[model samples]
Target: MYQTDNLKQKIKLFMIIFFPILITQVSLNLMTFFDTVMSGRAGAEDLAGVAIGSSLWVPVFTGINGILLAITPIIAQLLGAQEDKSIKQKVQQAMYLSVGLAIAILLLGLILLNPILNTMDLEYEVRHIAKFYLITLGVGIIPLFIFNTLRCFMDALGQTRMSMIIILIALPINLLFNYIFIFGKFGVPAFGGIGAGIATALTYWVISLLAIAILYKVAPFRDYQLFSSWVRPRVKEWLEQLKIGVPIGFAIFFETSIFAAVTLLMSAYSTNTIAAHQAAMNFSSLLYMIPLSVGMALTITVGFEVGAKRMQDAKVYGYIGISGGIFIALFNGIVLFAFNDYVAGLYNTDPDVIALTVQFIGFAIVYQLADAFGAPIQGALRGYKDVNMTLVIALVSYWVIGLPTGWILANYTSLEPFGYWVGIITGLSCGALALLARLIHIQKKYRNQIENSSAT
Candidate 1:
């Protein structure tokens, strides 16, 4: 009866924590879906253009944005410690840090843009169009980064629901611009992929502005002097946060690069196969947002508990969040398995493309469940500031095993697209296995330490 009651209470707490995150993550992914559909309407090349650029850019920016996540643990710890003074400074410092990270990525973007596209060996029209899109989309990086910083700052304070409202506004605004610029529906001339880039850039600024406005109105800490800090930044605070954040950034880079590399390999197959992979990938990405959000909540919860010295409760919270993630992922996996045809059909109009998409969707459905198998463990590791292992795991997962296996199948054998998805499954499964082992090892060690300390 005690166990039963405990399980029921966890379900209630999980629902409260999970729903808002699910809504926000889903909203943000919806924008990406809308962008893909708009690009699809333009042509195969246009679809390929955004895919190529985003394969590189999305992970790059998202990884950089992870830097600002320092605020969550910082704020959670301070809030637990009841240090209202440090909380304000920490938030201000995080903004500065986020902006710095964004600017650095912008420079990297400029240098990396052409070389990355050039190496792809695309045709003249395709390269030219893709370059234009990459450069224009690169312009949006600063706002996107800054917005992510602000969003994380809010999320740390438990006001993450703000992001959902902002994206709700940004969605129609992005679609309207896409309609106008992609087709020249309004007086604007048709620019296809380039127009899509501009629409995306404009929406970035709009969302950032809306985020600022909402925060100023609602966040009680608006009085904090970000630009004119009462004192020079405590360098120690900045360094501590970066120490925690940079490894996380690289961890994300290594994991996401697996997808980028696979997509590059997928180019070996016919264009239809790539399109099919895209449909399934895009669909899987939407589902991934759920687990990702749960991961965030788990990380924050664990961090908060650590800050408060509630070690046992943190352990319980980790189990609850991860278990909730597994349950939700299983349900999502089932739905994707059941509805692959219908979901793939929504984006893919080509009969051949639709057929290929079904197979890719089969892989996607399984990946959704595997996501639970991996991401939550990574999140728990993050809560403990143990990220260096992920870097090594990434080396093995993406570069050593995944890439080579994929190449052998795509180039050296007949498995083709099926081989590509199989390689991803293999890499994720191995990575998940490693992460689970590490998580158990560390948590048990920590529990022993806690027990000894209390006994003393």
Candidate 2:
């Protein structure tokens, strides 16, 4: 009875943490959904422009977010070990890293913006709009990174509800701004697709400022004293973080870049293809929030267990998380497969766009099933600080195997978008299987260590 009750308590705790994080993720993905839908209404060309611009920028944003993700487990473990004083310094270091990375991304975006667009073989108008969108969005990358850093910090402390509230508030604001700018409402001239970029930039700034204010004024966060003193960048700390974060960043880049590559390749086909791809991708992202949320929660949970020197508990939590994620993926996959046409219609009314979107959705369902296992297992590894291998696996699966196969199938066969999606499935499946195997190995090793210590 005690054991059953304990298991129930753990499940309840996981739900409490998981739901808010899931909602927060959903809100973030909704921003992209809004952008795509609004742009689609403008025209096919506008939709394609947003799609291309999103492909270019999402990788940059996600890569930086992945790098900053190092902060979460660091803080989680610190909190778990009751090492409260150490958190302030680490938080400060993360802030410095965030600002530096934001600036670097901004500069890189400026340098490569035009040249990258020119090489894409896009239509003149599409290219022009895409360039405008990319530049406008680029202006906000700094604040976006800062916001992400704050979010990660709070998440580590198990304060996801506040973060979810802030993001939920931002959603309506994003929509209002997108409406006013994209359609030129309330006396503003229509910026069309580029207007979505402007809205996104403004939203990032608002969210960043709000997050900072919350960290400063919130009663719970006051305990961390994150803002008590400003510290100069420490070479040792920064290098240590980078040592952990760079592999994470590269792992994210590998997965995201494959999709970006697919988007670029699809650009050569037709505007309809791009628009269809955008719809399918956006919906897939929305569904992805499920496993991703669970995975994120697993990171904090497992990190806490590890910090408490409860290796067996950490392993148990990892198993629960991975299993829950796969189950959710199966449920979502069924829904998507059954209702794909309805979902596609929600994005665009054009028959051609809808038809292509349905086909792409089929691929997305398979990809999600693989991703269900991949994402959470990766998160479990992060908690164990077992990341470098995951990076190597991602590189080999996505770039070495996935992309080349996709290229050949997409270019040489009649598969077109289907071929690219097949590649996504292959890569995600490979990643999932590899990570799961690693997790089993690590669990065995840790169990042996525990047994030896007990014997001693």
lDDT of 1 at 141: 72
- Model-by-model lDDT, in order? 0.73, 0.87
* Candidate 2 residue-wise lDDT, 1-456, digit = tens: 001125567677777778999999999999989998998888888889999999998887887788899998888888778887888899899889999998898888878998899899899879988999988887788888888988988988888888898999999999999999999999999988999999999999999999989998896887777887788889899887888889989998998989999999897788888899989998998899899999899888888777766787787788889889879999989999999999999878999889999999988988999888788998888887778998999999999888888888887899976798888888888888988998898878877888899999
Candidate 1 wrongly placed segments (more than 4 Å): 1-11, 219-235
Q: What's the TM for model 1?
A: 0.92
Per-model TM against the reference: 0.92, 0.97
lDDT of 1 by residue, 1-456 (tens): 001125467456555655676787887777677767677777767766666666777677667755666566667666655676776667667766777777887788778878887787565655666788767776777788778777776665656667777887888898898888877886898887777787888889999898878766664536544434445556777888888777777777777777877776666566667667877888888888887888777666666666666666667777877786788788888888889889878765878888888888888777667766688777777776677787678678867877677767766678776777777777777787888888787778778887899899
True lDDT of residue 201, candidate 2: 92
Pairing residues by index, what is the TM-score of model 2?
A: 0.97
